[model samples]
Target: MKAVSLVPSLTEAVAVTLPGVLAGATDWCTHPADLDVTRIGGTKNPKLDRILALAPDLVIANEEENRAADLDALRAAGCEVLVTEVRSVPQAFAELARVLAACGAPGRPRWLAQAEAAWAALPEPPARRTAVVPVWRRPWMVLGRDTFAGDVLARLGIDHVHAGHLERYPRVPLDELRAAAPDLVVLPDEPYRFTAEDGPEAFPALPCALVSGRHLTWYGPSLAEAPRVLGEALRAARR
Candidate 1:
């Protein structure tokens, strides 16, 4: 089946699990290093005309990663769209299965099984620590309540300082963030490219852990490696 995937993580999942089925994907779908699919612009602003031109049998989208108006436009053009809502590890797997099945992908993906086993075998973290994770810088938005990243961090024994905030992602001033006095500050590479020289300097008094955005925020095969990958980063942060 020909399909177009708008979400970067889901795009990689489909491309790796089923191959050739992906006719097009957003420019941000960077996994499967050798991927040569048609580029359909960014997740937030996909080239609707280009996607419609593909005439895919199925279109994979995420409730948060894509815009409602774009999905509606595709549906209005007679394309069968499979919108997925992945808020946690379990939900991600369930939605992946549902989307793949709906797209008629043959065979059970080995990576899916491996990811499940990875999360299942994860040992409970020794202790919990309070952290503030920033996703962007200019506006200073952070991970808040009901976020997949928050759940992952919680499982890894890090509690977000703003998880109880009304906004899922809220913009907090640097002064207020420092005032919160998180035990540590977690930085990811995307939505804002936080690096050793860049991010850690801001929280001079607090320890900082720089982690991969995919490992921290994405829910796909990366899940299989995240626990270990992120654990190392978090453990390496210095006071």
Candidate 2:
């Protein structure tokens, strides 16, 4: 079975969900070995032909990630395409269901059950607000309103300070950050890594934590593992 997953978050989900869907080993391949592919969300990639050359039985893309022209070109090339635009974790579950249905795989009910149970098993968070900085410095950005990251934060019952105040991924000035006075400023390690020692001296007065971007940012089956990890981190920080 050939599957093409365009977005990294969905690709990671497929990698985990395939075993449950196919009920066995399925040879899955993705454009980027990792999430750093330029076209996905990084720099610039002018190569749609590479994906076409994969000669996939099916290609899954997100409306937010895949350009319409690219999808049209893929359709023209006779590839069956499934598109998912997931802005929140609940939407992510729906998208996963769509991919499973398109793949003609069984075991979705079981998968969804497990996912639901796992989500329920998550512990209630400490009653403190949290702000996650999904991008590292250079421009210094944070997940604002209407983003997957913001949704994940909400699921944890942790408030994102910028949720209603700004656009998605707004560039936050250091002064604004000082004013928000978040309980925690989480710097995720992707797009760039911000080590603990690398904490901006300019913000030394702020409470900060350098964290795994994959855990906080990936919205998929990977989510099954996130709440526990995030919960532990927050618990430790509370002490």
**Which runs in model 2 stand beyond 4 Å of their true positions?**
19-46, 109-112, 132-134, 200-202
**Following a full C-alpha superposition, what root-mean-square deviation does model 2 have from the true structure?**
4.8
Evaluated at residue 48, the lDDT of candidate 1 is 92
lDDT of 2: 0.64
What range of 10 consecutive residues in model 1 has the weakest lDDT sum?
Answer: 99-108
The residue-by-residue lDDT of candidate 1 on 1-239, one tens digit each, is: 89999998888888888879999998988898899999999999999999999999999999999999999999999998988888788888898788777767675588888888888888887778999999998888999889899989888889989999999999999989989999899999987999999888888899999999999888777888888999999988757
Per lDDT, the best of the predicted structures is 1
Stretches of candidate 1 off by over 4 Å are none
Clashing pairs in 1: none
Clashes of 1: 0
For candidate 2, lDDT tens digit of each residue in 1-239? 66666666666566565532221111222312443222322212325666666667877777766678877887998988888877887777777787777876565756466666777776675465766454756677777778777777677777788788657778887788877877777776665777776654646776666666776776665566777777666555431
> Residue 77's C-alpha lDDT in candidate 1?
94
TM-score of each: 0.97, 0.80
- Model 1 — TM-score against the truth? 0.97
- Cα displacement (Å) at residue 78, model 1: 0.9
